[model samples]
Target chain A: MFDGITPQLLFGQLLIGVINGSFYAMLAMGLAIIFGLMHVVNFAHGAQYMLGAFVAWLLLSTFGVPYWGALILAPLVVAIFGIAMERLILKPIANLDHLYSLLVTYAATLVIEGLIRQQYGSTGLPYSSPLPGGVNLGFMFMPWYRLWVVVFSVVTCLATWLLIEHTKLGAYLRAANESPEVVESFGINVPRMMTLTYGFGVGLAGLSGVLAAPIYQVSPSMGSSLMITIFAVVVIGGMGSIAGAILTGYTLGIVEGLTKVFYPEAANLVIFFIMLLALIFRPSGLFSGTEKS
Target chain B: MLDDTTAPLLEVRDLRAWYAESQALQGVTFDVRPGELVTLIGRNGAGKTTTLRSIMGIVKNRKGSIRFEGNELIGRRTFQIARLGLAYCPEERGIFSSLSVRENLTLPPHLKSGGMSDEELLKAFPNLRARAGSRGTSLSGGEQQMLAIARILRNGCRFLLLDEPSEGLAPVIVKEIGAQLRRLKAQGYTILLVEQNLNFARSVADRHVVIEHGAVVDQLSNEDLAADMDRVKTYLGV
Candidate 1:
């Protein structure tokens, strides 16, 4: 089964896996944060990711902004859009059942996708490789931007982990997760925290989108399809945990990459199949400390 | 003695509160003086929890005045009420099972007046020190209750509304909790405790109030409560 797998091809696939993993890690990290604390499984996350890419494309094509500026501006722009959704759409339904949040967000996703499709058309828009060189790593040739994506994503994930786990705001967030009433007593406004947390999570999706624009063609449907795979990663990782999302995202991506080398037909189905197995064996996901909250 | 010169720390007048369509507290009235340990004794569903919930503004569809140190509590959010120096420990013991005992204790946001330092908080509850690194779910039930109380203490709230601190705990742990209540009282913290255990109520309550079917049935000092066991049994079914 492994006879035809060359080191060069394997290394190339691994590089691809790591890139995919970076996106998976970033997107799933956002999903876990929102779902865990706010109890909102934002179906709009993928649409936000797509919007991030579009924002970057628009900035570059229409305004002649550089890639560096789009990297920062696109996420901020998308994050504001996310905040708007939280305030106008999600906040009213905050007290309703979790299913309503899912339904509302799904509706929002459809609306966003439709609007983008209307403007951008269905054909994939090409984003020129902003960093136009590669480093030869003996077994594999690594694009500088791809390497930058991997490095930047790792830093983002680590920063997020520290923010949630080590900082004062993170403490309140965890406290809110435990007992919002007790946290409220301390005079930390919880609803405001919820709004910001949702925005931040959506911001993470947006960041992933911008990073991915240079790698793949910028398209409205990009985030919609990617979300399914990321959801599988979240399932295998568990929704209640941050580290679980990050680790599972990268691990599953590598597993899928390996599957492509060994059994090409199974590559697409690998993550979903692993999610099923995870549900059966460890329903809480790999790093999830407990069952559902 | 109830403070007469200054307004009561908490005043609830004609407070009507409900859960969805079910009226839990109807025209409830009470006053809790500063530095007092008050107990609300009632059978299950006597609106004991509802009264506390109303004060915290957690109750939906509430009408009436809940003035905490003179601020209107009716429209304030639960977090705002809490920031106003009131802490509510629910009956469910909402511990963050994923966090360590120490992390759970330290996770609350800081307060301006100052909360207990981790060192002092641990000194106050040595049992917690032993289980500081343990996950919240790994601790025993009694330990969890201790952790819950310790959590508020660490947050440094001066007023506390505890719902059934002694429920489902071992008698030894109940006595331990009773001791902590006395210590908290001596430190000048005002507490409104909802309890079913008459003995636990008698141990630390400076004054006692009884509720039946959403109304105040009786109010008495600890001395009067000890003297009138027959009436207590009749009202509380002790």
Candidate 2:
């Protein structure tokens, strides 16, 4: 049964799976952070991600900006929009139940997606790779752009992890999630932190969007499709654990790829299948702690 | 004690607060001068905790005035009120369980320049130094209580609103907490504590303001408390 599959085929699919995992780690991390800190389910996360890619596309097509500039500009612009959205839109309903926030953010997705669709339409836009070369690594043709994505995502995730786990600012963030009332009573501006943390989380989604734009089509619908996978990753990883989401992202991605190798029909369903098992076994997620933001 | 020439450090007047439709504090008024230790004493559901929360701005549905250091406090957020040199140690000992003991101590920012240094605080709460690397919640109840108070001390918050410091603690720990509070008072710290433990209150506080059904029913100096013990016992039912 294994005779037909070559090393190249196995390694190639694994590389793609890891690439998908990178996006999952980034987007799901943002979702986890937003949910953990603000209790906002942030259905607009995928939409915000789509906006990142669109921002990159718009910058290129409208202003003749290159990929390098959009890479820096796109996430920043989307992060600003996220901060404003948090301040003006999300803050009003922040005191309400989690369900209300989830509904609001879900509604926001439709509105944002609708407006972008009105401008860009349903047709997918293509983005040329910034790095065009590939390195042949025995069995796999490793694209430089793919390598860059992995490196960038790892660095971004590491930086974010260090920021939240090690730094003074991170300690405040963790403490706030544990008890915001106590944090505020200690003289920290928690409301402002919520707004900024929400922005930072969405900005992560936006960064993934910029990364995703080059690999996938830059369409309004792109995030909607990927969001289902990322949410599955978040659930399996646990709702608020930072490292859980990242580790689960790559693990499930590889599992999905492996499923494709062994049984093609189960490829799409593999993640949900694993999530179901995880829910039954570890309802609190793989990592168990009343832990960090 | 040095002469208190200035106005009272905190003045809360007619502060009515609610938890949704249920009223918690109704026209509650109190004052704390510099270097004073005041306690709000009451039974359960007597709004003792509510008064502390209202002062911290944790209870948002509050009406009337809360003036700290001559600055209006009712409309301000908790953090801003805290920045005005007020700190609150909650009833449950709100500890960030995931954070190390040291992290919890340093989490609260220093609002003033001159307060207990980390070395001084470690010297004061010597047990905390041993469990410095441990998660905050993993400590014994007494240690957690010590950490809760110690967390705020190094931040230069001259005023503290401590809620139930002796709740669910051993007699030895309670005595320790009492000793610490007296030391803090002697060092010129102002505190407003909420306590169900009448003996603990009697031991540490300079004055006691009694709360009954969310209103200020009585105020007594520690000297007056001995004379009014029967009356106070009736209010507390202990």
Candidate 3:
């Protein structure tokens, strides 16, 4: 089984693994951040991701906005929508059970995805890669767009981690997760902070969507498939653990990719097998800790 | 309404709050003048914590008139009440386990430079200064209480609402906390403390407002408390 495997095959899968890992990191980090702060599952997250890609596609197809401009604008637009959803829908029920948010967001997801499907008829749309070229490293071929995505995702994730762990504003966000009433009593508007935090988390997913548009088809169903994988990533990571979410995301993606190389049949099922093993051994996750910086 | 020229620094009138179907506070009323230290004393479930929480506007389902420095605080949000110079240190101490002592000290936004500067706060809390880089929850109980108080002091709130500052401290630490409060009062900071420890309250507080089953049963100045210790004790059930 190992005799026929070449460097091209090995590194190519690893490259694919890294790219998938980057998306996993972004999506799971967003989910973890939102849940850590407010305990909302945010089922509409996939819809938000889809909306980001759709918004970018629309900007290009209808308004003649270039990919670079869409990359900047799409995430912002989706974040604004998230903020509005938080204010009008999620905020009122925030104090209720954690399951309420999950249900509401689930309903919201259906409505959003249905609206897009109704217009586009569920067919995939093509998005030309902005960086349409590749480099031949002596061992493996590398697409500039894939490399860009990997670098950009890593940068964004690290920036977010630093912001939450090192900055004063991040300190407040983490504090609020522990005791929102106390934070509010400290002259910080905790409710407003909650709203903004939710928006920011959703924005991260939107950013991932913009990045995904070129790789995956710009269809409403795109987010749903990836979101399922991200949910598994988040669960294997742990509840509300930022470090766990990030580390598990990339590791699992790579593991899945490797499974594809050696045993093609097990690629799809590999992540769940790992998740089951992790649950039996370390249910809290490999990087689980109290909601800490 | 006729007292428009001046109002109490902190005032509450007929404040009622409920948690779901259970009523926590039933028409509690109290006031604290500037440059004074007031303590609220009661047995557990007597609504002492609820009263402080009500004044902070954290109890959402509440009907009351809470006036701070002539400003109506009833309908205002918690952060709004805080920005108006009211700080609440909850009974649990509300320490952020994730943040370092230094981060916790600086987490609250300073509305103005009034109570104490960061350096002054650190100087006052020697333990906090020593363990500045440690997580907020790593401190001892007494130290955590001191850090909780110190965090608010550096936050620029002139009026402080502290719930059970001396609840679980040693007699010596209680004395130290009492002394610290006295010093804060000397610097013209008004404090409303909820106390389970009668001796600590009798030592530091200028006055004691006794709560019995969610209402103000009695108000005693230091002399009054000293004269009638038994009655205050009966009210406190300690």
Candidate 4:
């Protein structure tokens, strides 16, 4: 195996790894943010991601919307859908146990996936790449679309981090996460903040879905397939740590890619294995100090 | 003693609250006039904290009237009550671990005019000025208590509900807090403090309302509280 391994193979896998990591980072970040405020695991994240891709596909097929248009519209549409879910379903049950939220969102995932499957079928649909080009780096050819995905995801994640960490709005979010009652007593509308926060978190999932469509193919089951891994990524990163989610997502993605190159059979199992290790060694997560209990 | 002729800044009439089926505040009644530092004194489980919480609208399963500035506070949300210029400083201090001292200081947006400016607040609480960049939780207990009060002061709230500000402080620090409360009262701020420290309460408060089994069992001015120290101590079971 070592004899056959080359720089071309390694760098190609590395790029692929980074690309996977980008999706992981973006999706996990959304989950972390939602959980941070609402204490809801948002089991419907997979369905939301799937919805993003389907929305983009529908826009292109039905209204002749281009990739650029879908990139902006898909997340907004998903955000609206997420807002409705929160207000109508999540909000009423908010005062109940966390288990109720988890169950409700899981049911939502099933419902959304079922609706899409009935409409579009189980088979994957192709989404034409918007960039449609590549750059030769001597060792391997890197597609412009893949490069865009990585850059866009990184920028999106960075922007979110800044919004939550540096701004007054972010201070409200952080304070709300700590003690919503205290924050509300300070005259900040916490319920409204929670609604908007849920919208924003799922919107990130939609953005990730849009970015993933051309590469992964739009399908009902796409999100469910990735959901387990994303959850594992979240657990390994820590339950509610923003930085943990972003950093672990990218790190684990690369780790999986490296496994694919070195031991192809173990690639899929790698993330779960790390999650198991993290649970045993650091149950609160690797980067949970900054987040609420 | 000040005249009791004017309208009360806050009037709690038959304010009953419950945590699930267990009742906390039962027919508790009180009045804090404008510019007065009123203290709610009781033993543990006497519902002093619950009274403050019910007033802030933090306890939803509550009955009766909480009128602030003559507006009914019952049936309103916590934020709505806060927007009405009422702020609560909880027993836990309720500081955010994620926010820096500066962020925590400026976190609550000013609901009305007359809130202290950043310079004025930092000047008033000099320890906060020095640890402006530190995480809110990183501060010492006294500093955290000070920050809790300081945050609410910036929100333009003339009426404050502070719960146990000197619960775990050194005597020196407790003296400092008492001084701060006196200064705040002199500046025309009205306070409703929940305290088990009768000595501290007598030092800072204009009047003391004693609660027993969730009802307003007694009221005393500072002189009366001093004269009736043994009886007050007996009421507190300490």
Q: Which candidate is the best by lDDT?
A: 4
Models 1 onward score TM values of 0.94, 0.97, 0.97, 0.97
Off by over 4 Å in 4: A290-293
DockQ of each: 0.52, 0.80, 0.86, 0.71
What is chain B's TM-score across the candidates, in the order shown?
0.96, 0.96, 0.95, 0.99
> A27-94 in candidate 4: lDDT tens per residue?
99999999976799899999999999999999999999999999999999999999999999999999
On the 0 to 100 scale, the lDDT of residue A225 in model 1 is 93
Worst 10 residues of 1 chain A by lDDT: A284-293
Tens digit of lDDT per residue, candidate 1, span A164-268?
A: 877767867877877776667556788888888988998899889989999998998999999999888888888768888989888887888888888989999
Q: Could you give candidate 1's per-residue lDDT for residues B121-213 as a string of tens digits? A: 899888889889888878888889988888887666899899999999999999999999999889889999999899899989988889988
lDDT of 3 by residue, B103-221 (tens): 99988887877667789889888888989999999999999999999999877888989999888789899889988999988888889998888888889888889998889999878
Give me the runs in candidate 1 sitting further than 4 Å from their true place. A1-5, A290-293, B3-6
Model 4 clash tally? 0
What RMSD does each model have against the real structure?
A: 2.2, 1.6, 2.2, 1.5
Off by over 4 Å in 3: A290-293, B1-7
**Model 2, backbone clash pairs (residues 3+ apart or across chains), number:** 0
Instruction: Give the docking tier of candidate 2.
Output: medium
Kindly list the per-residue Cα lDDT of model 2 for residues A1-293, writing each as its tens digit.
77679898899889888888888888888988888667888999999999999999999889999989888898889989999989878999987988988888889899999999998899999998989999999988999999999999989888887888889998988888889999988888899999889889988888898898889999999998888898899999998888888888888888888778878899999999999999999988886453454
